[model samples]
Target: MLAVPLLGLINQYLGFLAMIAAIVLVWKDSPWQKGAKVAATIAAMALLGAVLPDPPEEGAAGVARKDRKAAAARTLTSPSPSAAQDDPSPTTEPRPEAADYRGMRLDEARDKAEAAGFGTSDHNASDDDKNIWMRSNWTVCFQKSSWTGSETKTIDFGAVQTGAPCPSTDGGAIPWPTMPELTWKTWKTARNEVVALGVVPTEHLRADTAYLNDTLPDEGKYDNWRVCATDPLEGADVTINTWVTLELTHPDNGCPDPSQSKEDRVDLPDRDDDGDPDYHDPFPGDRNRNSVFPNGLPDSSGNSSGGDGSDGDSWNCPRTRWC
Candidate 1:
């Protein structure tokens, strides 16, 4: 009986056994006196109450603990509001707005379109699908663009050279400028004819002559040579991108037999008093001896027509005889 109350201090299970033993000793017969048994029963009951865990109470502190646990559980299970906003679903970008590009310079139109997030491509407005090499020299005649709101699109521009007029409509065969009759014409005249129409022909040396490429003094001076034949021939349709080749030879060599037909012969004007025509004379002014007597002057030194008077050289002679 004495040991029962002491054992109850260790754990609830031991305390429960002590309590039961004390109760039996008090109610049923015992070797100890009644007073002793009663005392032992009270001690066992107090110790059991101290050792055992307490049942939950409906109080303010208990409610606060419960609320804290619920908050912790929610933090573990749910995502933050900021996190949800940051990770939104994917979406397509909107298409750029359209605008009329007619009459604008091709280069300017390209810049404007690119700024608006649109890709650009351009073609000659004429019948030929010519490449737009010099954008500044061309003006937009028409534009074609199509796209859904969810997709991107490229703007196709139809253009002509800056000074020319635009076509009546878009997206069809554009009529090119007519190629002029360039056969037997001076290189300068032939070149000007095409350049006025915004085309530059490629010059090729057709005849075997001393003059070579553009490095020579006569390279860019177009009057020094004449066109033998043109690649596309005369009256053919041509565009800025057309492959034009002017087969050329020095004026002294003359054109080849094939291109020298009477119908193709061009009468070159004599711009200066020199007997030689403007195309044949390198120095058209009468100051040069070669220009004064274009045929040949009698040589004082030899039987030859002129002593060392090559095609372009000036001869020093006494002007009194032929004066």
Candidate 2:
């Protein structure tokens, strides 16, 4: 009729073959009877099935473009609840108020705990594993902290170097300086009790005939020498450069008996039994006839110059002992 709804708006199978060629040309030509050509071919196939256009549904236009791109990606990644209450959420800060940075000074208690917001950390409160390089020379001695927040808080501390003295509690350790009873004392009172316990004394002399004048023990004859066995012996703790040693001997040739054995503690004086002892026998009575202590025997200050008179000669050696 109108070419079968204008060929079904351009092709629904050419409007179903133009509505079957317009009902075979109105029933074989000018139809006007046969029930008026079956009511004009059923009103031209219901007006060409109401103007064509129906072949879609298989993937419905790709599910309507994936539901309009998932509603514009949820409206550009959802936001609005008043823009999520005007955006905020990052936080942290708090910390600050906690005191007692012990006797201060670890770089002014880490610059007063980083000006109160807090952070620092430290440790070695002096078991002397030393190393705090120069944080104002050290001091703090104990301090903790926790209220937790200043971007992760911190505090800790326990230091010690500044003239020492701190650990009796809060993270302990420091103390040191103990090793006292320096044997039978006397190398000038065990070098003034190892310089009043600041440590590092070092004497030695264990009698190789008091170094037959290779000198070095006369702090003005340090009370005729004594101390018997030390090197960390008596009590033991030390630190300020540690060392200690002492060992020496001469209280008229004594000390050496806690079950002897420093080569059986020799006090010298073999008077020619020739096992060589009058300071190594330069004829110490050649076989015991009558040598009232000759040549090599005088030194612990009875002084026949085995040195200290400055170079005694006659091969009794000691011109600083042969150089």
lDDT of each: 0.65, 0.66
Q: In model 2, how large is the Cα lDDT of residue 82? A: 86
Tell me which residue pairs clash in candidate 2.
none
User: Which segments of candidate 2 are over 4 A away from where they belong?
Assistant: 9-45, 50-75, 78-138, 141-219, 223-226, 230-235, 239-248, 251-256, 259-323
Please give, for residues 78-137, the per-residue lDDT of candidate 1 as tens digits: 879988898887888775566888889999999998788788888887765667899999
Q: How good is model 1 by TM-score?
A: 0.34
Could you tell me every candidate's TM-score relative to the true structure? 0.34, 0.35
* Model 2: lowest-lDDT 10 consecutive positions: 205-214
User: For model 1, what is the alpha-carbon lDDT of residue 47?
Assistant: 62
lDDT of 1 at 213: 21
What is candidate 2's lDDT per residue for 42-72, written digit by digit as tens? 9889899898766688699899989999999
Which residue pairs in candidate 1 collide? 126-174, 127-174, 127-175
RMSD, every candidate, angstroms: 17.1, 13.8
